[model samples]
Target: MHTQVAIIGAGPAGLLLSQLLQGAGIDCVVLERHDRAYVESRIRAGILEQITVDLLARVGVDARMRREGLPHDGFNLAVDGSTFRIDMTGLTAGSKVMVYGQTEVTHDLIEACLERNTPLVFEAQDVALHDIESDRPFVTFTKDGQARRLDCDFIAGCDGFHGVSRRSIPEERLAAFERVYPFGWLGILADVPPCGEELTYSNHERGFALASMRSPTRSRYYVQCGLDERLEDWPDERIWDELATRLGPEAASHMTRGPSIEKSIAPLRSFVCETMRHGRLFLAGDAAHIVPPTGAKGLNLAASDVAILSDALIRWYGEGEACGLDGYARRALARVWKAERFSWWFTGLTHRFPDMDSFARKMQLAELDYIRGSRAAQTTLAENYVGLPLA
Candidate 1:
């Protein structure tokens, strides 16, 4: 197969790129290792930054989201049983986040692609990207155990962190930055109703906990755990007990035990590749960078990448201009680093550090307190939460 662009991975980045490119009258093919069910069912981030919501609306993928997604004016920070709300709307002039799961967004995009007859190949395996330095870079893969190759003018390495796309570039030409936190989040999804109107981040001596929800009937929560903590070690009672302590006794009545749809431990980390493009191959989404879930920036960042990349490809194909393509990496990195810093700051504030002295702990608390009381601090958090307007 030959095309103008060959996009690896069917995640948010690849699918959204295909949609955007199609809108601009550009041709592209997408390859996915997972089946439709697996890709749509994988639960991930839930918060959509304001910029992300606007982009999705512009791309005609906001109907169901507008119907089902919850819009929150702000969030709460709880410490020592005292909860303080940051009014994002008041700070950002009506900007607010949409609470919709990454899975839902992926499903919507994939469905939209199918409806529009976009080219997407599922269950493609052994995907190998090659010849990035040449104008005719390509990807080789297997479909139903049959070998095939896709020749393209450019390759989008949107296959994510563990995929072969990132590693395809020679190590000597790549620079990496990474920071792994000492803790991980044990996240759970239950059928119970949510305890709060908006999400809450709690800081306690025991650990950090997050209270989030998908819908009125579905609640999602997470608790800080050791990196190697086992799922078997956390029974239903134990999970609820810890949640009660961290979220406080006020929310206990709304918490009801239900079928656990998902359970996994996600280690916190901040990672960025020095460059997002190597000749004809361009990296996007998790393939290029990762941020901890504290700031809810992961999926939003991926969407932002696709928005920028699609515009660059449009410029290249429509006007025969490569300048946009050439500067893609630099433009993306600026926003990536900003998000990395914000995620790290939020994570550091909520999670306990063994190295933190009494003074450090007090300082952290004071900062949180100040953020709750000060309009300037709230505006800073609101801007970061809603995302710095996409470059």
Candidate 2:
């Protein structure tokens, strides 16, 4: 098969890119290693930044989101037992975030592509890139016991961190930076109303806890746990009790407890590749960078990457312009670093480092105190949390 662009991964990043390129009259195809059911069933972050929401709207895939997604203007940051709300909408001049699941966005984008009869090949195995440094690049993979090849003018490595796209690049040609947090987040999904209207982040001597939701009736909550903790260690009663204790009296009073339908532990990490593009192969989303879920930046950051890539591709295809394509890596790296900074800083502020000395703990408290007492600091937090503009 031959195409203008061969996109790897059927996640939101790849699917959204396919929709954007197809709308711009550029032909592209998406290849996925997993089937549709597996992709949609994977639970992920749900917070949508303004840029992501707008892109989904522009692509005509946000009808359900706009109708069902919760719009949160501010969230509570709890220190010990005290809670304070940061008015993101007020601080940022009416900019707020939408609470919507990444899975739903992926599902919507997939449906949009399928409805238009765009090519989306799922269950593709052993996907590999060839001759990426040359003007013409192609991909090879197996489908149902048969080998196949896709020749394309450009290749989009939209696959996640473990995907083959990044590995295809030579080691000496790439620089990778990563930091793995000492603790993991233990989360549970339950069928119950959320504790309140907006999400809440907490800092207690026990650790960090978060109260988030996928919908009005389905709450997603997380509490910090040991790096070696397992789901078996946290029962539904224990989870709710810990969440209530960490979230404080105000939230605990109104918190509705229920049976957990799903539970898991997610390790936290911040990783970024030095460059996001090589020759005709451009990387987007998790393939390029990953942020800890602290600032709710992972999925939104992916959307920004896709936005930059889509615009670059549109410019190249529509007006025969190469500047945008040539500058993709630089533009993406700038924003990637900023998000890394924010996620890293937030993680430090809200969690008790196991190795933190008394002095360092004081410093952390001092920083949070400054943020709570200073509107300037709150504004900065709001700006980063709501997301910076796409490069």
lDDT of 1 by residue, 187-273 (tens): 999888888999989998888989999988999999999988999999867888898888776665556767787788888889999
Clashing pairs in 1: none
- What TM-score would every model get versus the actual structure? 0.98, 0.99
Candidate 2 lDDT at 216 equals 87
Per-residue CA lDDT of model 2 for 89-185, tens digit only, reads 9999999999999989988988999999999999999999999999889999999989999999999999999999999899888989999999999
Off by over 4 Å in 1: none
Error in Å for residue 155 of model 1: 0.7
By summed lDDT, the worst window of 10 consecutive residues in model 2 runs over 298-307
Highest lDDT among the candidates is held by which one?
Answer: 2
Model 1 weakest lDDT span, ten residues long: 248-257
**After best superposition, candidate 1 residue 191: deviation in angstroms?**
0.7
In order, candidate lDDTs are 0.89, 0.92
